[model samples]
Target: MPVSPTYRPEPRFFDLGGEYGDPVRAADFPETRLRFRNDRAAATVGLETLTDAEWIAHFGRFVPLPGQPGPVAMRYHGHQFRHYNPDLGDGRGFLAGQLRDDEGRLLDLGTKGSGTTPWSRTADGRLTLKGGVREVLAAEMLEAQGVPTSRAFSLIETGEALQRGDEPSPTRSAVLVRLSHSHIRFGTFQRAAYFGRPDMVEALVEHSRSLYHPDLAEGDVPGFMRAVVEASARLTARWVAAGFVHGVLNTDNLNVTGESFDYGPWRFLPYYEPGFTAAYFDQTGLYAFARQPEAVFWALTQLGGALKLIADAEALTEALNGFGPAYIRELRAAFLSRLGVKSLGEAADQRLLDTTLALLREGGEAMRWEPLFHDWFGGFASSARALSGPRATLYQSKVFADFRFSLFDHEPDRPERLEAAPFARPEPEEMVIDEVETIWAAIDGGDDWTPFHEKIARLRAMGAARNPTESP
Candidate 1:
C-alpha cells in the first residue's frame, strides 16, 4: 500500500474539555485482523503512508494518533423512540480524532466497538461482526445512490467471540471506523438543554457552527438552524427517492450535520410500497418507508427546539416551518436526478413526478422500485427493451401517457452512462435484506470477504453512473 509522505493531524474536539466528553482508552483486544481499509478516505487524512503494523497500532491497538494524546468518549443525551433518555451517551465508541481533508474541512474518525466507557453501563462495549459488515454495506449503497453519508473508513476484526440473541451465540467481533463530516448529533444539543444548561447549549452550538457551518456569523444560531434544517430536509428527501428506509430515526441516531451514519436495521425497498418497514421490532411502522419524511421533520423540529435556547425563537420557528417546502422541492429534484432527467421547469417537473408516482401506485402491487426509474432512466428516450417483468405493462397503459409526454420535453441527465456495458445486464446492484444476509453468511461461514468487497466495487460503478464527479 502506498503511504503519504507527510502526516497531518488536527486534534481540536478536546479543546471543548470535560463538559462535552471524557478521555478514554480503547479496549485491548487479543488480536487485530484488518478486514477492510478505505484507502480513498485514508489518503484524505494523510494516513495512506501507514504500514499495516502502524495502521493496526494506531487504529487497531487504539493507540492515540501521534499528535493526539487519547480518544475522547463524547457525552450526549437524546430521545430514543420519542422518549428522552438522559443516560444515553457513547458507551462503546469514541471520537478518535479529527484531521483536515484535501478540501480543508475537518473530518472526524469515530470508532464503534472500541471498548466500554462510563456510558457502557451493564453492556459489553463490543460490536458484532455482522453489525459492522451491515454498516459498511449500508453506507456504500447509500453513497452509490448519491445520498450524503459517512464513509465506512475501516473494519478491524478483533480476536474475540461474543454472544448475542440477534444471531448465533459466540459470533465474531469487529471494530468499525467511520469518517464523517461531524459527529455532532441532534442529541448533542439536546443533552445541553436536558440539564437546563442554556450556557452549555450555546457553547456546543458555537463550537459546532465554527467547525462545519463557519459561513454563518458568530452567535447566528438562526442562520445555523436554517442551514441544518435545509440539509436535513434534502437528506431525508434523498433517502425517500433512493427507497432507503432508515429503521430508526431517533433524535440520537440523527446527526445534526444531516449526514446519515450509524446504520442499524436499514433496508432499501424492493418495491414502491410505502408500508415497507425495515426493523422487525418496529411494531407500529413508526419509521416505515412512507413515514420517513415525517420522522425526519419531527427530528429536525426537536433539533430546532434545542437550538432555540440560543437562537432567536421567531427565527427558529420560521426555519423549522421551512422544512416542508424544502423537503418537497428537494424530493422532486432528487427523484428527477435518480430518473436521469433534467428538470424542464417546476410545473412540468412536478407534473411528470406526480404522474410517475401515480403510475407506480396504479401499476399494481407487483411494481418493483428500482425498475421504474431504471427502465425509463433517461426518460422517454429509453427503449421499451429497457423494462422487463410487471412494470413493463404499466408504461403501455393510459396512466403513463402524461408521464411519457412530459418526459420528452426534458433533457436526460448524463444519459451516456446508460450506454455503459453494465446496462446490458438484466439488473443493477441492489441491497435488499436477502442479499445483505447472504453476504454476511459467507463471512460468518468461512471469513470470505470477497462478496463484501465485490459488492462495494459494483456499488462504486453504479455511483459513477449516477454522479460522475466526486463530492467533498
Candidate 2:
C-alpha cells in the first residue's frame, strides 16, 4: 500500500459522550496477522500513517487513538424476528474510533469480535477467521454494486482457536474493523422508548440529524422519518434488484443511515426465486428475497412508533405510509440501473421492467438472476452474441416476447461500453452459497487467496460496467 500525505485522525463520535454507551476494553489476543486492509477506505480517513504492525495493534489491541476517549459498546434494544428483545445490544462489537473523510462525511470505525461487553451473555465473543473473510467479500461486493454499505476496513487473524457449532469445531479466530457512515440503529431509538425516556430519544434524533440530515428541520421526527424512509427504500430496492437476501432484518441490524452492514447468512440468488432465503433457520421465509421490501417497511413502522414520544403520530404515520410508493419507484429505478437501459419515461420503463421480471419469474427455478440482466443487459442488440450461447433456448421461449417489444422504446445505456469485451463472457459473476464455500475451501485447504482475490477483481469489473453514470 502506498502511503499518502493526508494521514490524519479525527475521533468525533466520542464527543457524543457516555449516553450512547459504556466504555469497554479490547481482548488481548496471542498474535495478530494482517489479512485485509482497504486502501481506498483507509486513504479516505487518512489512516495510512500506521504501519501494518501498528494497524493490527490499534485494531487488535483496542488502544485509544491520540486524544480519543475510551471505546464504548453502544446501548440499544431491537426486535429479533418480530419479537421485542430488550437484552440486545452490541455483544461482540463496539465503536472504536471515528474520523472525517475527504468527502466531509463522519465515518465510524467499529470492531467485530474484538471482545465481549456487558451484553455478551453466555456466548463467547470471538469471530471465526472464515467469518471475517466472508464479511470482507460481502462488503466489497455490495459497495461495488452501489449499495450504501459499511466496508470491512481491516481484518486480522488472532492466534486462537474457538469452538462453534455452526461450522467445524476449533475455527480460527479474528477481529474485523468496519468503516461506515453511522452506527445509530433504529433500535437505538427503540431503547429510549423501552425505558420511557422520550428526552433521550429526542436527543439522539437531534444528534444524528445534525450529522447526517443537517438540512432537515430540527427535532422534527416526521421529517427525520421521511429522510430515513427514502434512504431505506433505496437500500431495500438495491438488495432486491441485486438478488440479495439479507437473512436477518432484525430491528437492531437496520441502521438509521439505511446502509447495509453486519453480513451473516447473506446470499445472492442463484435463481430468481422470490422464496429463496439465505439463512437456513429462516424456514418461515420471514426475510426471503421477495419479502425484503415488506420487512423494511415494517421496520420503518417500528421506528415511527419509537418516535411517537416527540413527533405527531398522524404525521409520522403519513411519512411511514410513503414507503410503499417510494419502494416501488426505487425498485423500478434499481432494476433499470441493473439492466443498463435508459429509461423511456415511467410508463414505457415500467412496461420494460415488468416484462423483464415476468420473464425471470416464468423462467422459475431454471432462470438465474445475474445472467438475465447479464445476457440481455442492454436488450436484444447488446446480447445478440450472448443469446447465441448455451442458454439461447431459454430466451427463445414465448415468455420473453413482451420484454422483446419493450426494447424498441429505448436505447442501451453506454452501448459503447457494452460493445467492449468484458460483458461478452459466457457467465455473469455470481455470489451464491456454493461459490462462497469454494472460496473458503481454498483458504482452509491450501492457505491460498488466489481465488478470493480474483473474485474481488471480477466483481469490481462487473460493478464498473453495471453501475450507471447517468442519474435516474
Candidate 3:
C-alpha cells in the first residue's frame, strides 16, 4: 500500500518494555465488513487517502502500518465502582499503533473487541454491534459539543453472533478503532503502585510527561499532577455543560490526558435533572448528572495516591486540592461558552451561571437541555429569535426572569452564528436515548443504515454551525 507523506509512525509504547504490556494478535473473524470510517479523523494522520480495500487490509485485517509495531495489550489496574480491582487491564482490546498528527501531537490508534489477552479472564472479548454503534454516536456527539473526547476512527462488523446479558442474545459483533491523545490511564500508575514498584511508577511518570506534557520540567511530578488536575476539571465541566453523563467513570476509563473515552451506557440529558443516571444498573446514582465533578475529583485523589510512590505527599495533596476551585472556574467558562456570550467578569459570570442553573432546575422537564443553549446561544441578542420559537411560553415564565435579565448584561460572542442553518430549525440536534434506540432499531430490524448515516451527516452539519472555526 502507498503511504502518505504526512503519515509519521511513532510506536512509542514499545519503549516502555515488556513490563507495561504484552504482544497481541487480532481475532480472525469469519468475515470483515466495514461499517463506518471517519475520514476526517484519518486525515489527521494522513490515512484518509487509502482505498477502501487498503483501509480494510490495514484496520480490519490488523496489518501493521509502516514503521509501527504490532498490537500490544497494555497492563493496568483500576478501581471499578470504588472497588479496587487488581485483575483489570486491556481484556478485549490493544494499543494497535501510534502516529504523529499534522500538529505534531502523538495519537494512539487503539482497538475495542479486537481479541482476547491475558486480562480477558473468563468473559468473551467481543463487542456487540449495537455497542460499537453507540460508541460512535457518543464520540461524535461529544466532539460536536466541544468536549475533549476520543474520535471513533473506524468500525468494522465482524461476522459473528455474540451472547450478551445486557441486551438480546446472539447479537452481531464488531471491532472499533479509536483515535485518542493517549491511552495511559490513571490506572496505569495504580498498577505500578499496587505492585510496590516505585521505579516503575517513576518511569511511567517520566514516559507520560515526555510524550504528552513535554512542557513540564523533568522530574516535576507536582507540575504534571497540576496539569492533569486542570485538564480533568475542564473535561468534567464540559461534560456538565454538554448535559452528558458518562455512566461508568472507573479509574481505567479516566485517562491521564483527561480525554473521555470507553463509552458504555453513556447518555445526554433530556432535561436538567441533577440526579439523572445513564447506566440502568446505577441505582445509587454514584456518577449522576450533577455529581460528575465530585466523581472526577475522587478519581484524581486516587491518581494522587499512586503518584505519592515517587513524589512528595504534600505537593500531591496540594495538586489534588485544586480540583474544586478549578472545576468551579472551568464550569463557569464552559457554561458561558455554551450560551455564546462574552464574560463580563468573575462575579458577574458566577451570577449568570447560578441563575442559569436555577432556571433549568425550576423549569425542569418543561425546558429541555439542548434547546435552552441552542435558542439562547447569543444571549440577549437571540432573545427575539428565542421568544418567537417553540418554547416561548417557558422562557416567559417568572422562573426564567433572572436568567433573562442576566443575559442582558453580556454581549454576544460571534452573534453571526445565529444565522447558521442549525439555528433555523425549531429544535437542536439531540442524541437522547429514544433517538439512539430508534436508529439502532432501524439497523437491527432490517440492517437499514440510512438513519445512522443521516444522523452522522446532520451531526457534522450541526457541529460545523456551532463551531465555525473548527473543521467539521
Predicted structure with the largest TM-score when compared to the true one: 3
lDDT of 2 by residue, 13-84 (tens): 556667778888988899888888877678788776678877876788877765467678999899888999
RMSD of 2: 2.5
Query: Which pairs in model 1 have colliding backbones?
Result: 3-48, 3-49, 4-49
TM-score of 3: 0.99
Top lDDT: which candidate number?
3
Q: Assess each prediction's global lDDT (C-alpha) against the native.
A: 0.84, 0.84, 0.92
Cα shift from native, residue 407, model 2 (Å): 2.8
After superposition, candidate 1 runs with Cα above 4 Å error: 1-7, 384-391, 470-472
**For model 3, how does the per-residue alpha-carbon lDDT over 1-472 read when each residue is reduced to its tens digit?**
4568899999998998999999989899887899999999898898998888888877888999888879999999998889999999899999999999999999999999998899999968889999999999999999888899999999999999999889898999999999999999999999999999999999999999999999999999999999999999999999999999999998999987889999699999998999999999888999999888888999999999999999999999999899899999999999999999999999999988999898889888988999899999989988888999999999877768889888789899988988888889989999999999999999999999999999998888888887897666
lDDT measured at residue 159 in model 3 versus the true structure, 0 to 100: 91
Q: TM-score per candidate, in order?
A: 0.95, 0.95, 0.99
Which run of 10 residues does model 3 get worst, by summed lDDT?
463-472
Residue range 1-472, candidate 1, lDDT tens digits: 4346555677878777799999888999988999888876788788878888878887888777777768888888887778888998899999998888888888889999999989999889999888999999999989888899999998999989998887898999999999998888899889889888889888887888898888999998888888888889999999988889999888888876789888688999887788899888889999999998889888888888887777788989998889899998998898898888998888988888788888777776566677777777777667554546345666677777867877778788887877765455667778888999999999998879899999998888777766767432
Question: Candidate 2 versus the native: TM-score?
Answer: 0.95
